[model samples]
Target: MNRPSLTWKLYIGAFYLFLFAPLLVVAVFAFNASPFPSPPWRGFTLEWFTGSGSIAGKPGVLVDPIWLESIGNSFRVAIPVALLAVLLGTVNAWVLERAEFRGKTFVAMMMLWPLVIPGVVLGISILAFFSRVANGLEDWLQTDLDFLRPGLPLVVLGQLSFILTIATLIIAARLRKFDRSLEEAAFDLGASRARVLRTVTLPFLKPALIGAGLVALLMSFENFNTTLMLVGSVAPLPITMYGQMREGASPAINAVSLLLMLGVGGIASVFALTSKAER
Candidate 1:
């Protein structure tokens, strides 16, 4: 094959630059000694990541309670959201792929509605619907439905609205490629349906399950629109960072961005390795 032309090389270079140049800038600024995440690079320092209150007169991202709490909140929402989304998505995939049910096409299309809806719209809809339900229940029964309020539970549900669809798609794609003969053979060998599913089907779907869970985790962690609408007193990392940015840009924000990059990169790496091993 002929070598790539200069124009092709230039296009590829530009594409990657567009994709990663901003991230590179953020990574660089995370180490900047200056207060702001901008140039006139002051000498490098670890203040953004590790400064003590007394030494730098400002706490670092690791030591700051706001950042720490926000980070904790993010994991709190993301872990459960990932687990539930994957579990439900797996069930949905199995039913859609295996069960010959009426209105199956309609059900599949309806499940995809969440994926097509804008995040802002999904967030607003969940918030409004839950708020109304909470009000109605309180009026009728004089009971408080605290879970329906704009808090971590609402935030988890909001993220799940769309994330579940994504997980379903991922798992269903794998399920579609599965050979029914494997299940048939197992059944002929006297294995129970549950045993066949647990041993053969689940083993085959492991990669897809893991991939969907990791993707869901990352999406929930980075989600801002739905979280913003549904979050109560406790904010996730993305929400906290947004508030910080609105006040003023700071190197500390850069530090957080860098950490996020590392985290997302790590997850992606794990997925890649898992996929490779499966292959």
Candidate 2:
């Protein structure tokens, strides 16, 4: 391969720095001794990361009651939602990529609709759909299911609406390049369809499945708009942090922000590296 010009290499380096400088600033401020998150560095301090103000001897955001509660709630919503979204997405990808059926194009298009739709619109639509469906079901079945009301469940569904679509596309991209003859060969060799899938197809799809799952999980954890609309009483980390910011949050928020940036950045980096390796 021909070496890139010095200008091109410099531009790539500059682009990366441009992208990551702000993140570096936030991570640095997380340890800033100052009360504010911005510049005017005030000596280093671990208090934000690990020190209980007044609560049980525990320390840091991990110990704060509100932060802990919100984090727990976020995990509660994110984990199951990720699992369910991945399951549905993997199945959808398989069906769309491998199956030949009437209206498959239409079905695939509908599956991808959420990707193009605005998150706010998707949230509002989900809320409306939940209400309408619940009302109709209550009328027909004569049972009022209060769980259908906006809350964590609704937030999960709202996030799932688009997250699943993303996961489907990610997995489908890998699936489209897959060789179908492998599955056929396995089947011809007396392997059951389930066995072929388990031993051949699933293993080949593992990286994409994992990448899509991590993406979905991260998206669910940090979701704001869709979760905001569907959340009734339960507050996830993002929503809680948003409220705190509105009230003029303290430096603790910087600590949280730094952690989130590191986490999301790490996930993205790993996915990118693995993708490059696969290619």
The number of the candidate with the highest TM-score is: 1
lDDT by residue for model 2 (1-279), tens: 498999999999999999989878767887877666777887888888777764313357866788889988999999988899879988999889878999999998899788888888989998998899999999999998776888888889899988998999999999998899999999999999789999999988888888888899899989998898888888999999999899874778878888788788898998887787668
- Each prediction's TM-score versus the true structure: 0.95, 0.87
Worst 10 residues of 2 by lDDT: 54-63
Q: Itemize residue pairs with steric clashes in candidate 1.
A: none
- TM accuracy, model 1: 0.95
On lDDT, the leading prediction is 1
lDDT (tens digit, per residue) of candidate 1 on 1-279: 499999999999999999999989999999888877889988899898988856556789999998999999999999999999899999999888988989999998999889778899999999999999999999999888999999999999999999999999999999998999998999999999999999999999999999999999999999998889999998999999999999998888999899999999999999999778766
State the displacement of the C-alpha of residue 216, model 2, in Å, after optimal TM-score superposition: 0.7
Count of clashing residue pairs in every prediction: 0, 1
**Candidate 1: Cα lDDT at 207:** 95
